[model samples]
Target: MVYLDNAATTPVHPTVVQVIQDALINDFGNPSSTYRIGKSVKHALIQARKQLAELLNVSETDVYFTSGATEANNWAIIAQANKSREFGEGHHIVTTAIEHPSVTNVTKYLETQGFDVTYIQPNEEGEITVQQFLEATTDKTIGWIAMAVNNEVGSILPVQELGEAAYEQKLWFHVDTVQALGHLELDYQALKCTSFVGSAHKFNGPKGIGFLVYRTYQEHNHLEPLLHGGGQEGKMRSGTENVPYILGMVKALELAKKDITSNFEKFEELQAYLLTSLDSIGISYEINGDQKNRVPYINNLWFNGNIASQMLIKMDLDGVYISAGSACSAGSLTESEILKAYYPNQSERWSQSLRISFGYQTTKADIDQFIHTLEKITKGKIDLWHSNK
Candidate 1:
């Protein structure tokens, strides 16, 4: 099967799998125990955190492990909102409409809890400018929430500039780096965000393991514990650590960091190959995000007509697994909120775009198979279909 949906999740790397397996078999002791086995396990956890921190260019003390990106996003946004609302800090938030549901849902909940939120819409190219955010910022705005890279269209947000804005205004800024973790080079120090999150599965690591990195930019900057139990993660997040998964995640991160540059160059080649193949087939299509400010891993394509759902089925049947949008909402195959925000008036664009993402394993042969299958499915009606503006 040609799996071009790496933006949803990546296949676990062999090295990471071996690490997790070894941990489960030989390092099974709980980190909390005082025995020698436990002491060694505990040291491993600390080292995992340190290694992950080094990869993201952050301090080890700032990282806290969690279930995944969803939980990390919730903990960061909800905790900050609660702090601002309860402690009289501020009751307003600034975020983008194209953010992952984990963020949008939290902002929606905050609205019901009496905190005002501004959802910034992306421009036609699926890019949000720093000026738009700065203009929306008000004195009552306490925090800013956004993603480093959009999962749907791969649009790279102005996170650095937004971070600078947040820093100058002394506002709490939390970035969801879920899609950016391995694909983009993140200078955590320069980001100036109060916190940012990463999910292991997106980077060829084991699922069910991710981390959150928060900093005390202000004296009151603190996140209340989301879970109550053995008081893990410095008491900010509670639950027994998944040592094997942690090992797998850190190993995956190490591999990604080592190969990021080479992978990027490879992706550039793949993108060119894809575009040329499409043109050779005379298939009418357009990229769905800001061409200049996007990642090469995920490419959202707008085909000629409202045929994404049908194309998804045809591709799946042809053994080329792609999706119309985020896998989280694929059960319903709903319109992409990311595209909606970018082209609010153009329903055709939002409902018809296919998300074709590449991973470390994706190859030129896979692309050839995808294009061939796509050509067969789109045969005869190619003239009837016209790519929307």
Candidate 2:
């Protein structure tokens, strides 16, 4: 099958799989234990942290692993909110309308706790400008959270500028880089944020493992721990670490960094090919966001006279897999909130959207087959697929 849903998750690399298998079979000792085997396991964990730190251009102590980006995001936002309360700052937060549910839901939950959240709406391009964020900020605004790249439309935001603004205002800045980790050239120090969250599954690493990078600028911890136990992860996160998954994530990240340039060029070519082919097929379509600013790996397209859910089901049956929106909101028949925010008046466009993401494993042949299948399916030829189903 041609899997075009890399935005959701990627297939783990064979090398990473092998490393995880080896660790599980040979190094089963707990890193928190004081025995020799445990010490060795602890060393493995340190090495993995160091490797990832180097990849992100940060110190090893700044990286803290978690169950996934969701937990990391929750910890960062909630902890910062708590810190704001302790400092007597009013309950106000700044975020964007196009953020993933990880950030959106947490902010919603904060509202229930009496915090005021300003969701800065994006322009038609699915991007929030720095001015928009500045306008949203108030004296009570204690934190700013946004995503580096939008998970649904792949729109790259002005996160660096926003982070700088937050720093100038002394408001805690947090970025969800789950979609940008493997696809973009990331310099954690350069991002200038209080912290950033990422998931390994988005980069061909194992699931159930991700990290939060906390900038080490001050002596005191600005954020509190969500999980408390043995005081692990510099006393910011607690739990016996998943050593095998950590090792596997490091391996996968190394591979992604090693081949990022080549993979980027490949995806660019594939994107151009797919769009051109779609035009050649004489299909009516409209791109959801600003094509010039989006990452080449993800394409959010709107086909005329087609429903996203119906098209997704047909595409899956035809061996070309894609998604309607974020996997977190998959199977929901309503329009995408991101699209609605982008086009507040044009509500019908949201139902026609499909998110097709590319990966390192995607090839020209795969795109060609996908385009052909999509054309046939969109041409009102559904009897065969329905009969087979």
Candidate 3:
């Protein structure tokens, strides 16, 4: 089947699988143990952290491994509120309306506990401007969290601008870089954000492992540990470190970094082909995000009158896999909250949206097959509509 759901997750790379297997066979020791096996595993975790830090352009001490981006996102934002409650700097947060549920829900949870949150609306282009962010900031705002690239629509946020704005206001900045990692070049030092989170699986690595990178350890705020027991990840995150998965994740990033330029070029070519084919089919589609400014791998389209759920099922049946929206909220009957926030008056248009994402393994042949199947499906539906007319 043609899997176009990279925004959800990706199949682990063969090299990554091999590395994971090696770690399981050779590095089976608990990282917290005082014995040699433990020491060895600890070293492995340390080395993985260092490699990830190097990729993010941050210090090794600032990189903390976690279960996934969801956990990292929760830990970062909630921790900001918790710290503020203790130290009394602020009780407010500013985040875009398009945040992944990981950030959106956590912010909502904080709001229930008396912390105020301002959800900034993005423009029609599915992009949050620097000015909108600056306008939303208040003295009570303790932190601002947003995604580098939107998980559903693929719009790239002005992270550097947001970081600069946050810096000027002395507010903590956290970015959910889950969709942007490996898809874009991210330098935590360059962006100057307080923290950024990335999940490995999005870049052809194994699931259940990710990392959070802080810009600096000095003056850094701590989270109330989500999992307690072993004091792993410097007590920021606690538990036995998943060395095999971590190693695989590191190798996946290594591969992505080495071949990113070529991969991006290939995706752009595929995107152009797909768009051309869509145009040729005479299918009515609205590009959801800023097409010129999005990541090369993602394309969110609103098929004017078609039901996204029906199209997804039909695509799956035709051996072409696409998605209705973010995989995190896929299969839910409700409309996309992100779309609703941006196009509040257009429920029909919003329900018709679908997100097609590419990955390292996507190819021209795959796009051709998908476009052909789509054309046939849409043509049959159009014929039926005219008959009814």
Candidate 4:
């Protein structure tokens, strides 16, 4: 199948798989052990952390490893909330409505625990303006949470500018950079964020391994351990380190860092091909997010009168695969919150929205084939709508 669901997850690279296999076989000793084998494993773990730090352009001391992006996001939010509670300083958290389930759900959980959460809505183009974000901040607001790049619509948020605003307000800023890590060049020194989260799988790395980057070691930003045990990852995360997965993640990130430029060029070619074919089909479509600020790899399309799910099925039958909106809300197949945020009171029109994403494995031919199938589905849907009328 011509898979277009890179946003959901990606297949692990062969080189990464090989590294993982090697680690599991030869470096199975516990990193905490004092034996020789343990010493070697410990060294490997440190190297992995340093490699990840290099990729993020942060100090190894500031980087903490987690199971995945969800866990990292949870830890960041809860830690900041706990700190706020302790000081009675800033009990309010500011986030956007277009955030992923990981960020949104964590914020919702915080609300239940007596923390005030302000959910800011994005503009019509799925972008949160710096002014709006600043307006949301108040004296009680402790943290500003937003994504560097939206996972569903792929719109690039002005993270540097937003983070600066949060800093100017003396508030902690945390951004979910899971989707943006490898696709976008992140200059950690320039971002000026209090914290950031990224997943390895999004960059063709191994699953179950991710990292959190924080600016300083201030106790207010200090996170209470989410998992309690042998105290891995600076006592912030517990349980034994997944050394094999960590090593593989390092390899994948290095690969992405080396190849980002060419990969972006390839995505541009695919986008051009897709838009050209869609235009040729005479399909009336609108881009869901701000094209000028969107990542090159994703295009959220709104076909005027066709149901996205039905169109997805048609494309699947023709050996193409795509997602509706958020993969985290899999099987629900409901109207997307991101769409609703942009076009309020237009729930009926959401069924026509489709999220098409590409990845390292994607090609021009794949876009051509998918577009051909889309045309057939669009024409058939139009005829059916007219018939019912």
Q: What are the root-mean-square deviations of the candidates from the true structure over C-alphas?
A: 3.6, 1.7, 3.2, 3.3
TM-score, candidate number 2: 0.96
Q: How accurate is candidate 2 locally (lDDT)?
A: 0.86
Q: Which parts of model 1 are misplaced by more than 4 Å?
A: 380-389
Residue-pair clashes per prediction, in order, are 0, 0, 0, 0
Clashing pairs in 1: none
What TM-scores do the predictions have?
0.96, 0.96, 0.94, 0.94
In model 3, what are the clashing residue pairs, if there are any?
none
Candidate 1 C-alpha lDDT tens digits along 1-389: 78999998999999999999999999999999999999999999998888888888889998999999889998888887788777787799999998998889889988998989999998655678888888999878899888999999889998999999888988899999988877778788788999899899999999999988888786776778889888899887777899999999999989998998899889889988998999998989999878889988888999967478878777776778988888876488887888888878878997788988999998999999899878877773333243211
Write the residue-wise lDDT of candidate 3 on 1-389 in tens digits.
78888998999999999999999999999988999988999888888888888877778987888888988888777777788666888798888898999999999998899998889887766568878877887877788887899988888988988898888888888999888888787666878688889898999999999987765422647656668887887786777889999999999998998888888888888888888888987877888866567877888889887787777767776778888777785457568887887788888867899888999899888888788767766766423222211
Q: Kindly report which residue stretches of model 3 are placed more than 4 angstroms away from their true locations once superposed.
A: 216-220, 330-333, 381-389
Displacement of residue 16 (Cα, Å) in model 3 is 0.2
Q: Give the worst 10-residue stretch by lDDT in candidate 1.
A: 380-389
Error of 4 at 234 (Å): 1.6
